[model samples]
Each structure stands twice: as structure tokens, then as C-alpha cells.
Target: FASGVDFHSATAVDMFPHVRAAVDSGEVLLEWDGKNGTPPKPLVKDKYASERRKAKTLNFSIVYGKTVQGLSKDWGVSLGEAQELLDKWYSARPEVLEWQ
Candidate 1:
């Protein structure tokens, strides 16, 4: 949604007090548990690390109108790999791809 869509929105000040009162009730727990879940393993370091980050960057940039050649040069990937990455990104986020 765009920020412009909220232009017509309004709220009653009278509702704010009740909302604040509900928030003060211990109904919400605002702290995280101390357990630390295992973090994701870092992507393997290889000749492909730069290639892969480049590929993803190309996909991200192209979605916003960057040309294939410019994205390839900026991200240092070949055009074919950039195209493949764009395919993968769209496959992963079909809704977003549809929006594009």
C-alpha cells in the first residue's frame, strides 16, 4: 500500500484512552524468552559467493527497472546468471512477481 492511501484515514481520540487501558493490562508479554535459537549457517564461502550475491542483487535491481547490462556490470554477474536469479526470485515470490 502507498502512503497516499492513508490520506483519508481518521481516528477518534475517544478510542485512544480505552486502547491505552487495554495495553496496560498484563495481557501482552513484551519480553523475549532467553532461549537463543541456533542461527542460520552462513552461506558457504566459495568462488560462487560473489556470484550468488551478485545474482540476487541483479534480480532485486531489475525488479525496480535496472537494465540487464547495467545490473550485470554493477553486480559482476553474467547476463545469463542474472536472468536465472530473476527467475528464481520470481518463483519464490510469485505474488510480488505478479505485482511487478
Candidate 2:
């Protein structure tokens, strides 16, 4: 199905939508009962804020024309690492790098 596109979105052109496995698929905080007759409540959560925040910073940095040096400084990583990360990203999405 062709979902409605968000043309007004800032990262609409940069990011591709993806579906991942549910975070709380197996991990559950079940209420204990005296008897084992209680039905299990399916825990449902799929948020990973910290990792998402890190990725968001890197992504937006690239979108705003950040260089490998700037990325290295922002992430406190080695310059080589920063360059490698940028290289990996550009390799994965060649069209984006080509567009820029």
C-alpha cells in the first residue's frame, strides 16, 4: 500500500521508513498470581530513545553539511572513525551523497 507521503517533513527526503521487530515482544512485566491460570498480558513498547537520539544527531549533522572533522568533534570519536562512518553511510545511500 502506498501510504500518504509527508511532503512537509524535514527529513522526508533523507530518511526511508523501516519496520523493526517489536521491542517488548518477549520481555514482559507480568503480574504474579497465586494460581497459574492468569492469562499473560502482552507487553507492547518499541521505543529506543537514546540510540535514536544519537542517530538523529548524526543524520541531521550530515543533512546540514557537517564534515567528517565536525562529526568527529561532535561524537568525540577519532577522525578515522568519523570518516569511516561517513563512508559507510554514503556507500549505503550513494544517491544522497551524489545529490549533495
Candidate 3:
């Protein structure tokens, strides 16, 4: 990882306090509400501890060169929704995309 972050039990999103805060606060819009399709809505908080899984999926997904279609399938969402999430995540962490 560009940040060189490591974890033992939980994903970085759940393991790191700052990462958890960022995710919970919508600093990283990984947690989304898929029920609303017209305009995918982003959930500001990971009330059910979903952000950790999303962050973990994104980290490995990005490294593996996953496509928007792949993300769409992986997250059970539409391509546009997946692309939107990737755009937001990349916008929030340009350094990660730059490193890639």
C-alpha cells in the first residue's frame, strides 16, 4: 500500500483509528446505499461496520486493476454507481491513484 499500512486482525479501515474516523465521517465514500438507484446515495456512517469490508475490498481491488464492471458485480451495483464510488475514493486519495 502507498501508505505502507498493515493490519493483523481488522482491515486498515477498522484497525486504524484515523482511518475509521475518516470512513465513518464520509471522508471516504465507500459505504453506499444501493437501494436507491436513481442517484446512488452515499451513507455518511458505517452503522453496521460495512466500511471496513468496503475499504478492504477497494484496497485489493485497486491493486488488482479491477474495472468498474468488476466493482459493479462485486458490490452488486450498477456500473455508474461503481464508477462514482471509485471517482470519489480516488478524489479523496489522489496519492493512491498516483502511486498506481
Candidate 4:
């Protein structure tokens, strides 16, 4: 990551090879520090939680570039239901919605 190799250009599946190779070759090490550092909390609890939930909900939308019908088929829900969820997700994360 520090090597300035931007992995964001790679697809989700495409990056797996490098990650797997790193672990398989023991090039990666995992350790936990015993420091009791306080984890910074969210600035807006309710809205942040909502945004997080919405972001998760929209992951499928982005990953699949789903249409209402496509989301309906994938989630086994009606098109209207999928659209409603998608709408809520967009409302919660307008920037993400704007990107799409």
C-alpha cells in the first residue's frame, strides 16, 4: 500500500491474487498492540448509523449496477420493494447516490 500502487483501479476479484500471494508467502504479519487507545466515535450517531446502514445497503447496487428489476431478482423481492430500499439508501448517502 505504501508503494504507491493504487489498488483501487483493480476490480474486487482482481485484487485477491496479490492479497492471497502476500499471505501465502508470509510477507504479511499480524499483531495487536496492547495500547488502550480510545477509538474515535462518530460525530453524528443517528445519522452516521443511518448512513452506514444505507452504504451497506447500496453496496449491492454499486457492485451489480443493479436496476430495480435486477435488485428485485437478486434479493427475491418485488421491484417496488427494491426501489424503495434503493431510494432510502440514496437519501441517506446523497454523495454516493450522486456518484452513480
Highest lDDT against the true fold, candidate: 3
Q: Please report the TM-score between candidate 4 and the true structure.
A: 0.42
Model 2 lDDT per residue over 11-97, tens place: 222222321233224333212342776436422211333334555576677889999999999889999999987876576457787
Give the better candidate number (1 or 2) by TM-score: 2
Candidate that would win on TM-score? 2
Per-residue error at 74 for model 3, in Å? 1.4
Off by over 4 Å in 3: 1-48
**Candidate number with the higher TM-score (3 or 4):** 3
How high is the lDDT of residue 26 in model 2? 35
lDDT of 2: 0.51
- Residue 73 lDDT (model 3): 96
What lDDT would each prediction earn against the true structure?
A: 0.42, 0.51, 0.61, 0.46
lDDT per residue (tens digit) for residues 33-62 in model 3? 356563243333343345556666776787
Q: In angstroms, what RMSD does candidate 4 have relative to the true structure?
A: 14.7
Q: How many backbone clashes does candidate 3 have?
A: 0
Candidate 1 local accuracy as lDDT? 0.42
Candidate 2 lDDT for residue 70: 94
Clashing pairs in 3: none
